[model samples]
Target chain A: MQPPVLELVDLKKNIKNKEIIRGINLTLGPAEILGFLGPNGAGKTTTIRMIVGLIRPTAGSVKICGYSIADDFIRAMSNVGCIIESPEMYKFLSGMENLRQLSNMDKRITRQRVDEVVELVGLQKRIEDKVSTYSLGMRQRLGIAQALLCRPKLLILDEPVNGLDPAGITEFRNLIRRLAHEEEMAIFVSSHLLSEAQLMCDQVAIIRQGSIVKTATVKDILNTETVEWRLDNPVKAARLLKEKWGIEALRENGNTITAAVGENRLELINQVFVNEGIELRYSIPRQNTLEDMFLDLTEGDEIA
Target chain B: MLRLIENEVFKIIFKKRLLIVFGILLVLITAFAYGQDNSLNRTKARLAGRIGITASTDWKKLCEQQIIDLKNRLESPYGHEEDKPATRVRIEQLQYYLENNINPLDSSAAKFTTQFMEQSIFLFLPLLIIILAGDIVSGEAANGTIKLILTRNIPRWKVLLSKLAALLMLEIIVLLMAAVISAAVSGVFFGYGGWTAPVATGFRVIGDRLETLGVVNVPQWQYALMVYGLAYFVSIVVGTVSFMISVLVKSTSASIGVMMSALIGGNFLSHFMSDWKITRYLFMVNLRLTDYLAGSFQPVAGINMAFSVTVLSVWAVAALAISFVYFMRQDILV
Candidate 1:
């Protein structure tokens, strides 16, 4: 229904004959959060960099808000907000002053917009403090505040919650969710923490060895592989599931049965195992988690 | 571009370091003027005392008597004017006055008083330039602000142009401060209205047969302006070169060290290159813009105003080109 806010088509990046990002294709749509998941050297940062125009792609092209990154750099960049690596800022300046100066780069971002974004990032109380005195979490919040100044259509943050403490991480997660939910911004965030991605993102693209191994909705990815289910009786459920419901399944050990589950299989199996005469200690359907899925996808290739 | 240049110019002119440099120059210029003024006053007083005695105040007759007294006392060669050029010239010129009534020292008192202002413009202003121009860009790079500036998505050319504008503004400010301090201090000591003052230098080499231009009498104000302008230009060229080296080198110390070495080395090499036949192209030779004030030939024999202008212009352009090319393409890993 809505045009993609940010799109990368078969992008490749090479440096000194070493390929960093090998053909990554991704699309971010309105009010969608795409979790870009990968290991440390799996081209996660490089792909995000190309999207934000920090570096040029060796091949393919990137488009932000329907504008080509190469042909219309200013316009494309105008629609995208990005935080690359750690928050690099002028430490000598106050957070508010830093935001004010960066906001001046684009003519459209006014003083009111800077104030609004500062408040949105929950840095209103400490905006006047110099960045040199900010803790890692506070700096991260300021970085996000700077990115949101123009209310960009697309926001790219690489490991946005990397250095946040537990409470800070909770606050950042809620703030990102609110920005996407209320502001209707397409959010593309990359992180190595699969649990963080699962809790934050609606859609995701998993990268391994500079290639996108899997991309889908969170439910679809969690459904891709079967999870090993542990039970009190084990082999009885696999035999019963296969024989009774014509389901494909596998038995791991005396107390565990592994089966690929569909969307409503959890409810169906709980009913089915209760209806049967087996002593149902636990009848939960086994579905692959994001962590397991990430490992399965990236396990075959060299990380760097 | 103008806005960027304005911001940069404001930063340079308002920087505390530049203010400190101006303050140092002001102190040195004031001290030199005060010191020179005291010596001039003492000389004037001694000459006045020689001329003020009664019975026509015959200073030469009295000096001769004093010399005879000294000769009788110490067996020294006294009152002989034939050996040393300066003393011989002074004694011979005073001989007529010794026969008449004019005191020899009072004859040149007006000339000495007039030339002191010109000497300030020539000598102290160049030192002021050296202090500011030596560290223009190196200071920014040393503070790690260059990368922060470059990442603003402002074009690389704009960044360099801004820096050049800043350096140019500081150079002008320093030059103006020197000029004002010189004018004010000289006015305080020598009492202003002698602006048509004459200046003299010891060695004026007259060239052969090209319309023999005699002693050039530049008004004291014009001489000050010319010396300040030329000194400012020389300082700006050095500042631009130092900026280029700052962009090229990794460390600020190295940038300052290299440019200062090149500056000192250029002057040192120019001394030997007088016989080298190609010393005219060296930027250091044109540094003595005051030589033109004395109605003499330019520094490197045949390199006139047009040649000095061309060489200095070329150096400035080349330095700017190298700075832009290197800075735009540098990988800002910092």
Candidate 2:
């Protein structure tokens, strides 16, 4: 069996004696997209930097394809391609020239590979133009193109969709999914867009205060405690359930009543309503979402 | 490593307006050449008129007559005491030329190139070097492109070396530009000659009147080589200091400012406080090591080749060490 594509065994970083990144243990397997979800100043970028060897970790280790980042840095780095912060390149150079410069680091990438990545990112039209002329989306695409040039087994992107347009975001989302599926690459992304993460990530590790508060598969995060019910007279139904069953419905949006309850409570809720004179409308158990889990896990102190 | 250096060279060519330095050098050299040509032409005409009225063909008599003429000119009301040393040196030079039957006005590659280097080596060459190398490291940080470089899996020291190598390459180009421009512009006006002719140098000031001690007759081109060679050396030392500052300072403009003040103030301090023994140890004060070649007079004695080289070397190593140590261990906050 192949080893996991990435392994972080309790990585930590301390800046000025302050723990910027506490112990963060994470593992990403082949073809899995792991979202590093965190609020501002939660050390997402710092952790990524440590993994790429841009900065040394104060404690623990990062293993890429079973190679320790601290002991076998170059080999570990050879397996990883990342942008720990905003995508940046020499603005005076053309997109193609930027790729060519990066290609010097790894001999495996050639002109053919550069052209392929550029075409894949849809930057062939502007590949020859200086990056100074590129729009935010174009630069982001070129950033991805550069990361993809060497065919890294583990790809990390930090806030990749921050500046993209709506159409560009959708296109990039599809491209990332395709890269994971087609190349069998283990991809890691750090973002605050919970909705975007819900759609794009296979697993998520929510970080708060420099520590991993929770880590779970996206499907499990969506299998949360908060459930929504579709019933006739949601307002009256909410009051009736609160008064009769002492079960508080948290919110009522239109004909839907939402409450913090487990999936097993739906049958009991319907039984109680059926015993009353209120006619039972069709019950729709709204799926739990990552957003609900993110807020719940973070204590709702705004994800900046 | 070769590829890293090549990448740095590429960035130097494209990321900054290096051509601006080249262009400014071209314009300044051409303008200086134009002015020198007009003055040289007028002096040539005057010398020819003087030669026309001479009655004797004896070289000794001509020298005597020219000496008297120079004396009378010095005594004239228009001549000032401040101009005495320069005027006296010109007279001494003329006497040597006449005694040897060489026409000083005859434009030769040696004469023009010598004059060109003397005018360039002091402040002009260093100014241009400062402009080109001022942003070597700091500019990368300011542009946010340092992330691209540092993330390349290459070691940090190797990356710094690449930048230093690129700066050295840039220094060579600037020196070459100066040489080629001066040679070309002065060649056009002076009809370049005397490249192989012997030129006398190694003069030292004594008392008030002009005196030449241990005059070495080297080929004109050989003399030009030594002059440009020393200028290039000084520029590198200064450029290295600038690079060191560039690494430490994050703001490109601030880096340039810090180095410029050191350079200008070095010269300023040397001029005002040459008596202070402490000033002799400053790199900027000792940067004029070429002055030792011409045996130029200094208010102090410690500014020599050995002193300058030692100071510059120490500063270079210290700065590079500080740069590597600080950057390697410190956080890249940006």
Candidate 3:
């Protein structure tokens, strides 16, 4: 099997000896989107910076498409396209001029490529206007347009949708998904908006206090051990499950009882509820969202 | 590397203040030329008034009459020994003009060009440089756009080099604009041609007396070029220091403010503390490189062309090196 598009091994950072990022390891393959979740000052931006070569890592290395960032910075960065934080632009320049300036950094970005990106990001109408006249959402589109011009194989976006409206976010999300699948590019996105990440990403890596606490597929995070049960007379249902199966009830809402489900617990719970003559409305596995899972994992810490 | 510099150029011209600055500069040059033209006309009328008293058209007799007028002025208390050599040189020049049947009071554009170069070295160009170069590095940092560029595959030193190249290009353009406007406006007010007219330079002031023993005469056009040559050198030296300061600071406004303060403060201190030996080493003192060309008095004696060039070069090189080193090592926080 080929190496993943991006691989981090024991990535660590220490600023003033305080350990900003501590031992981060991750792998992202082509055509995949990994959501990076962390609280405020949890070192998401620091890790992104280290990956893009903005700040040197104190220890360990990042490999992009088999090129080591520390040893072959240019080659590694060449395959990567990133937007860290809100997309700030050269406000004095026209949108077209700004794109042209970025295009000059590489020779392969032809005029046709520039037009293709402008079309991709839907900025053709106001491309000639100075960026000072642009709304924050327009700048975001322009930033993404520039990132795509070089046909990068890995994309990193840090809070890329902060200033975007709902419609713009939807469009941006669709565009990112298309880029990942069509171009076979890996994407690493760090966002505080868990709902957006849930809808957009394939996997999520939850970070706490600079250490990654969990890295799981979105399906796995959404379908963890927690299971919800809907029952008539849920107080009686919870007592019957505790007494009959020696299982503890985790949470009880008005019409529902949720708990840490054991292996094959669905059928067992239904059989126990039926045998005890406790009225049960329905028993279905709850589809958890990324927000619920993230809150559960991060414990409601501040998100920077 | 060249493309990076092209990107930098795009950024600078995109700034709206560029055209505004050039406009003010041209208007000021025109106004200054108009004023100088009026003053020259007044001087010519006064000289003609003195000449009208003479009955003969004989050149030697007219020269003698002008010499007598200068002598009367020198006899007054306002004229000190310090003015003697320049006055004597002027009298000799008039004698030579009379003998050659030349118009001594022609008021050519060459004189205005020289004056413009001399004033611009101390004032106009440095201010323009401070406003433009001041924003080159720090503006990006403050705007957080620096993260985009630094994350590119290029080395940090090359990025600094691109900015430095853009700055140097802007400095050259400023110098060229100074030369162009001064010549064009003054040429409109006064007659256009003075290329071959003699300009006497290399007079030294020795012990309260102006010495002219080694005076050399060059054509006015050559003299204008020499003046701008020295002014251009000072512009580079001053502009580079401003670029380095821009790298050190994080905001465009603060960078421009800091550099402007140093320029204004340096000039202010040079005026008040010129007698101090340490004052001679200040970059502001060395900004007056054209003063050496005119053989003017040194604020601190023994400061000369070679010394000023060496000091300014050292400062410029040091500032440039520091800018590269700091930018290369700096962590992009934004």
TM-score of each model, in listed order: 0.70, 0.85, 0.87
**Each model's fnat?**
0.04, 0.46, 0.69
Error of 1 at A46 (Å): 4.0
Candidate 2: residue A34 Cα off by (Å): 1.0
Candidate 2, B90-150: lDDT as tens digits: 6776766565555545555456766666766656677778787788889878876777777
* Per-residue error (Å), model 3, residue A82: 1.5
Q: For candidate 1, write residues B49-77 as lDDT tens digits.
A: 66565323545655554344434444345
Give the TM-score ranking, best first: 3, 2, 1
How far out, in Å, is residue B77 in model 2?
15
Report per-candidate DockQ: 0.16, 0.46, 0.64
* Model 3: per-residue Cα lDDT over B175-214, one tens digit each: 7777787878899998778878887667565533445667
Better of 1 and 3 by TM-score: 3
Q: What is the DockQ of candidate 1?
A: 0.16
- lDDT (10s digit) by residue, model 3, range A40-150: 888999999999888889999999999998888888888888898887778888899888888898887899999999999999999999999999999999989878878
Candidate 1 C-alpha error for residue B45, in Å: 11
Clashing pairs in 1: none
Top TM-score: which candidate number?
Answer: 3
Please identify model 3 stretches exceeding 4 Å from their true place: A16-18, A228-257, A262-264, A270-285, A300-304, B42-106, B205-211
Which 10 residues in a row give candidate 2 chain A its minimum summed lDDT? Answer: A295-304
